[model samples]
Target: MARDYAARCPVYPVRNAWLVAVAVLLAAQEIGAPKVQVAEELEAYPTESVELSCQFNDGGGLTKLTQVSWIWEPSDGHRDNIAVYHPVYGQSFPNVAFKDRVVFLHNSLENPSIRISNLRMSDAGRYTCEYATYPTGNEQGTTTLIMLSKPKNSANGVTVQAGTKSVVVARCEAADAKPAATIEWLAPVGGNHSTSTTSGPDGTVTVRSEYRLVPTPADNGREVICRVNQKTQKQPWVYPIKLSVEYLPSVSIEGYDHNWYVGRSDATLVCLANANPEPTTITWTAASGPLPETVVVEGNKLTVRKVDDAVNTTFICEVKNRLGSSRHQITTVVIEALEDPSSAGVVAGAVIGSLLALLLVVALIAVLLTRSRRQQRRGYPSSGDSIATGSGGSNGGDYGNKARLLFSNSGNNSSKNGTGTNNNGPIYTYREGCDATGTLTEKANDYHHHHLHHASTGNAPTAHDILLSSEMDEAERRKFDLDDSMEEEEERYDRFGGVAGGGNILPPAYHVHRGHAGEEMDVYLDDDMESQRDGSVISRTAIYV
Candidate 1:
């Protein structure tokens, strides 16, 4: 009975224990394991290195032993086993490229972390970290490494002179690059140019650019720049330098006046010039002809003394510097001479003489005209003279002849009386010549026959002849003298004599004459000869007292 009980209990009880173990294994598969997430990635320069690290959760297991492994996968899908560690296998690396350059700092069974050095372009790839455990199954962490290229080395230098023509050369170089950089000159590009490129000792390429041009005055204060270009950049870099240069001088001249007159005492002019270096020589020369003896030049001043009338005289001022020489010219002219006072005086005298001659001719013409008018008013021929006479008789015949004689000689004494006259009495003797004495006598008988016919019948003898004889006295002759009178009396008689005298009878009588030797005879009479005249005979003489 005991043997039969042990066989039955053994198969049945052991089968039940195997079924419980399978159930526990199935529960462990349902819970998920903790994992490390790689949220960011990095890349580094060619000369630098990178490290990747991660943290994990053990899922409450008492045993700390676990498996960790590192693997690398290239972009071409090739996998490389890098590092691994377990409690039994210890730390191990599979590839030679990761021998010393790759390192794991933490124990892979407890933690998963890594470091890498001496990175190269070939080491660029994606990496993975995996963990193995009993309770919490498999987990993974990922990392990516990328290599970066370095910038190329390019530089240049330049030099220039101020204010002159110049050339500038810029050289640029770069080494060990997949693609080379381009070189350029950043200044104005239109002038002359030359370029050369040569390889350096280190297998790097170097380029040189040269530019040549004539500089201006504005270039003195300006700058020249060089620029370099690379493929990775949008803008180029610049380097700058200043320029300087040297040159020649300029000249100008100014004078006191435009034209210098002849016989001027002095003439002067001034000159000026500009140059970097002062001029060594300054000279003044006559441009047209030889200079006068009085011409003088002192420094920049030109002077001419005692200038003469020599057409146009030209002068030049020349200035010489180290670089070059320059000159300026001036011209002068002279005037004619003036006249003297003697010539002016002669002209004035001629004019005055002509005016005086004209005045004299006009006055002579006026005098001739006045004399012609006077002749016309007097009823006389302008070119000749004439005389008229009348006769007087007794019965108006001899009496008319006597009156005519009286009128003709009114201005003279001859016709008034020639001898003594009687008035109805015996004849009287009239003295013919009383030359020795101033007395005259008259006889009665000489006059009786001349007057007897008119004496009777109450008719007396006319006393006209007696009164005319009385006018022959010395006192009346003295009163008639007109030579001593002013010229105004003579002019009145000559101009108006006919108009002043009317026709009238004058008295007539006898007269006695006397004379001195070598002298003209004179006439005289006594008043007693007219006393016996009768009243019937009329006396026609009108006496002016």
Candidate 2:
């Protein structure tokens, strides 16, 4: 085996060795690699600062921690170093422009992150984070930077009267930022300034600026303004302001009172006038009357200490300013004293007494008329009986026999015996008398047979006997009959029949008779009568006297 140690050359073998080298290269490319990616592509509000971080994964075992750096390459092609960190030597270096403003935020072998602060418009550019190992050489991650600008407010303009203060406000807003902004105010020359800040719902910030100023007379034609500031950029933003002022006079006055009563001791009135420039003077005049010497006038008020009985009086107050004059007036009235209560009361009482007397007279007349009517009604007499004298002349008499018989029958049984006048003015007399006839007929039927008798004179008749014959059957007779002889004598003259004599005459000589033999009588008459044949009859037979 030692003797054959000679070399053998073959082309296929060389070709196979070339293929193996190519395969090794492909495997290295697939197994270990450096990759770059960005977490956030965009940002806002540079005042809050920003960070760009680079990370490595699955690094082929060549981790010797060679190099890591951050750079800014502007759109204009200018490049500047930001930060460089090396594990072996700690922090290698940092750019002078960003020495204290940039930060390296990593301590491990995996991360290379950088932070920049106090950003300005010039710093906005493309930034790259690069990392390298001993064998892998280098890998980089990139991001774009944009500097935020502060929000600006619109111009504001306002005008105010001279010596008067006015307020003006302006607002500006910016949103979705890392940090909030501030607000400020700017006023015109010789004006005032103020400011305030607030946050919004979407992480935005708002600035409110306010301005106030008391304009001078010279500033009447000028202007003033308000402005807002959001400090997102380097330069402070500005807003314009315009202001105007006006001037005029003001007048005020006071007097004793709006409503004044007459007879005041002394009235004082005053007038006051003020303006940007004080007024010159004030004067007062009477609008319609010669002002009383008692009137006192002051700066703005006038007083009349004593007032006389003036029917019409007026006071005018006038004030003068540099530009013009103004005047006002008040009027008053006076009258005589009021009447006393005593006199007024006397007049009123007299009126009431006169009315009462008139009413009394009217009532008296009505009563007299009513009484006269009643008396006339009662003066008429009822027809019943009359009487005739021996001379054969008729006379008016009282109630006739029929009426007397009814009274006589009722009186016989009545417990009370008296003389009384009926509503018709007829006098009735009642007394006890005998009804001797033992008649079997009803009382109503027996009334027809009974004869009533009235006195020929005023004297009532005495009791008399009523006899019937024993031969007659007393029980069978309907009523007792008066002896025909006695009745015949009583009716001797036809003058007493009907109402000829007794029925219509008042009784002076004749009176009512009752209780004579069971009879009673009522007397009624209208006037004295001599005979019943001579009186006038209107509706019925009249008694004549």
- Report lDDT per candidate: 0.51, 0.49
Per-residue lDDT tens digits for candidate 2, residues 417-532, read 12211111122221112231111112212221332222222222221211132222443222224465433332331223333433433323223323224343323232222232
lDDT tens digits, residues 24-103, model 1? 88767535533554525667545567876766655445434378788888667798888887767778888898798878
Model 2 vs. true fold: TM: 0.40
Q: Using TM-score as the measure, which candidate wins? A: 2
Candidate 1 off by > 4 Å:
1-34, 58-66, 75-77, 133-138, 157-545
Q: How well does candidate 2 score on lDDT at residue 440?
A: 14
The positional error of residue 394 in candidate 2, measured at the CA in angstroms, is 26
In lDDT terms, how accurate is model 1? 0.51
Q: What is the TM-score of candidate 1?
A: 0.29
lDDT of 2 at 287: 70
Task: In angstroms, give how far residue 288 of model 2 lies from its true place.
Answer: 7.8
